[model samples]
Target: MKTLSIDIETYSPIDLTRSGVYKYTESPDFQLLLFGYAVDEAEVHVVDLASGRKIPEDVLSALTNPLITKWAFNANFERICLSRYLREHYPDYFTSYGEDVATAKYLDPLGWKCTMVLSASLGLPLSLKAVGQALQLEEQKMEEGTRLIRKFSVPGLQGRVLPKDSPEDWELFKSYNRRDVEVEMEIRKALEPFFVSPNLWDEYRRDQDINDRGILVDRNFVESAMAMGKRAQEEITGRLQQLTGLANPRSPVQMKKWLFSKDHITHTLCKKERAHFIAHTSGDIHEALVLYSQAQKSSLAKYGAMADSACSDGRARGMFQFYGAARSGRWAGRRIQLQNLPRNSMEDLDLARKMVKDWDYEKLSFFYDEVTDVLSQLIRTAFIPRKGYKFIVSDFSAIEARVLSYMAGERWRMEVFAKDGDIYAASASAMFHVPVVKHGIHGDLRQKGKIAELALGYGGGEGALKAMGALDMGLTEEELKPLVTSWRATNPHIVDFWWKIDRAVKEAIENHRIMRVGTLTIFMQKGILFIELPSGRRLSYVGAAMKMGEKGYKTITYMGVGATKKWERIESYGPKFVENIVQAVSRDILCHGMKNLQDRYICGHVHDELIIECPEDTPVYEITETMAQMPDWMPGLVMRADGYETEYYRKE
Candidate 1:
């Protein structure tokens, strides 16, 4: 057989939502209940492994045959699950991945193809049923998938009666499995024309290997941090109760009533509403608000997730989701949500880490206001290097800003990056026509430049400044509009770039032809608007069209995931499109850096930073030099990297 399309129903007592599939499958109770397959687009077959039915010898051999390609939706699930199934039922057919057969991990991902990855490349839905509906495919996944899996795929409980699976339901379950393979096959065929390049597939393989290798987490720190968080919650909740005399100070209804009693101001007790009420209230009410804010912060829960999600080997796998940002093709954090991790700010982070690892709750309380807050800051320390290894954490400096300058032909901004000068200082110098330096002469002006650079980069104005926490950064209510104006006036080329992109996109979508704006190639094809980046990968806008928007101005409309996270028709203008192009190109640059170093090291990469774990003797400068090497695709685009060596991951 040239190809095998497969899907399997699995059972595991472990909570798959909290712990990832890797930890879930490692459970002793884990097992495969059903296996469905189609060979070379032939008739689909259901192998009821739970009922003792076996896969044929030829197909069993095909699982190990590198010549035959294997296809699946979310291929990682099937590959990892099937590896365990093979080791248990067909050891002879299972290929050894490590030095010893008994110690082997899982099947190699060399010959595997994921239809989900292909769908993401086309900017399609990640779900099988959703993709089928979106593509209007002939064979669709069965709608009863969840019901059947919940009934047959979970373990039986003692004395907990469940409805017996009648003969009809059993047959239906088998058909559900069979239909899944057919739907996956159909999706594979439908998306073949938009296939991701082999280079991208190679990157996917590296992503998988990094996930499979997992990251070593300090279990002692994780567990202690969770315990300290629980204590802090109890103490804060108790303090609030004692101060307010409310039954539960955290309850919105009770807190609202209590606040009204103190200040005669009644409002909704949600986070924003409460903050507004506090800003207007005084004395005990304000104290209560501070207490409530302290109690409601959620940073400690991440440590709990890390403690629970860690595998038996004390490593956390499946923490990064490849192509998680389908639009920009960037990875998103899975378990513990590392992408949104809290920044560390304690005076002596190492001492705090030691105290947490030592489980010295008294010391933790003495040095920290909220023990839970300390625990939250200590999340980075939870990811420790393996024995005899140190982490070389390196990342590009102002990568997005640099790419924006290169694409917009902002010469002065490019020179700032090239000269290794602080962009914020350069921006302040430009906006005020005076010499500026970070924390030096004209240092106070740096705040304006910083806020402007952040808020006005993508055609944002006064509103974006406020949204980006300008007021919190010591800017006044009257300063926002001026900040936006001054920044835009100084960076005229970047502002002009936005409108040019808008014009080119409108022209392309109207005429259904290719148009060039700056370094970007824009075209409309088969109801999709494709923006080709410098890396040769395109960003797709599904169902492209032009419509009069807001005061008779024209705008581009396309189907995309909106703020509500539902796939719907959305609107975009020039600056938003530029944002996408810049981010996508930035992702490609990170990919190039990772590709260059994946052979030697690359434990995990978050945002723009790469975490490398190697021997204590490994030079951090060498890793920094490797990351600084510019890719050939964007020649003249200068790149710089900064890093430091640490026994654990933390910003230096």
Candidate 2:
């Protein structure tokens, strides 16, 4: 058999949602109940493993055979689960497959293909059911699978419903397993035209390797932080109760009512509002508001997540999801979202971490005023390298800005990057027509320039400025309009690039023609709008069309996963498309860099940063220099990487 389409039903006492699949499978009670398979275009078959039936020997041989490709919806789940199964039941075959099962830790991903990744590559939904519905497949996923899974797979639910107890459900469960393989095969057939590139598959394999490598968690640090967070929360709750005399100060409704009744404050007690009230009010009200804001800091929850998802070896796996952001094809964070970890700005992070690990609450409180906030800032430190190794954390410097400049032919922005100069100050200088420095003459304008650069990059105007907190940064509402105009006026090429892309997209959809904007190519293929990036990776827009807007201009629209995460038709324009292109290119660059450094023990990555677990003697510049090397697709794009060596992971 050239291809093996498979699906599995697993039973585990571990909470798969809370702990990741790696930890879930580590449970001794974990069992692969049903193994369903279809070899090539043959009839689907279900091997009831839970009832003592064994998988066919030929099919089992095909699993370890590198020539035979295995296909599944979320293939990672199947590949990992089957790896455990093979090692346990078919030890000889598992060990003789060419790689050491002990050190390699799982099945080689080179022989596996994920249909979920394929669906995502086409800008389709990631779920099996959603993709089947989106593709209008003849064999759709069974809706009854969820109920049957809950009945049999889950443990401690009314004393574990077994096939002996519910024979009818058992038959349906086997059918559900068989139908999943059929649906997966149908998805592959439907998406056969848009074949996923080998490079992308190679990148997916690298992602799997990184996930399997798993980052070591500082168990002592995580446990201490969690315990400290609990105690700190109790103390803060008691203080708020004593001061406000409210039933629950943590409750927003209760706090808002109390604040309005006592202090005449009527605004919502969100982060910004709480800060405002604390600054304005005095005495117990001020103290209580400050305490309330401190209590609301949820960064410490990451510690709990790290603790939960960590495997028996004290490493967290499956934290990054490939193509999680389908629009830009950026990897999304799973279980313990390393993507959005709170920035650590504490001057004495090492001291605070040491105190917490020592469980010295008194010293910690003495050294830090807001102890809970300290814990929040120390969250990143929980991910530590294993003994005898250090984490060499490196990241591209202002990657998005550099990529936008390179693509738009913004010369001065490129110049800034080339010289390793400050883009924020350069942008401010260009916009205001004055020499702007970070802490020198007219340095105040740098903040305005920084905010303007961030907000106005994607064709944002006054509203974007406000959303970026311009008013809080001391910029007036009147200044936002002029700042946007000034930014656009200074970066004329970028503005032109935006409209050029906009016009190209409009032409591609309306005229049914291929259009080129700068180094990017836009075309419509079978109702899908493909924007081919310089890296040769295409960003897809499904069901693309153009309609006359109320403003008398043609507005481009496409079917995509929207803000609410439902598949629907969404409107788009040039600047937005430019944003996607630039970010996607940045992602490609990151993947390229990771490929360059693949020989190193790269544990994990967060956005543009790569966290490498290496010997303490490894030079930090070696990793940074390799990452800064530009790809062959874009010759003139100036790239720079900066890094720091740390025993534990942290934002430097």
Give the winner by lDDT.
2
Task: Supply every candidate's count of residue pairs whose N, Cα or C atoms clash at under 3 angstroms.
Answer: 0, 0
TM-score of candidate 2 to 2 decimals: 0.98
Q: How would you encode candidate 2's per-residue C-alpha lDDT over 536-562 as one tens digit per residue?
A: 888999899986767897689998889
Candidate 1 runs further than 4 Å off: 96-103, 156-165, 264-283, 548-553
At residue 388, candidate 2 shows an lDDT of 96
TM-score of each: 0.95, 0.98
User: Model 2, which residues run further than 4 Å from truth?
Assistant: 95-103, 548-554
lDDT of 2: 0.89
lDDT of 1 at 359: 87
Q: What is the Cα-based lDDT of residue 78 in candidate 1?
A: 92
lDDT of each: 0.83, 0.89
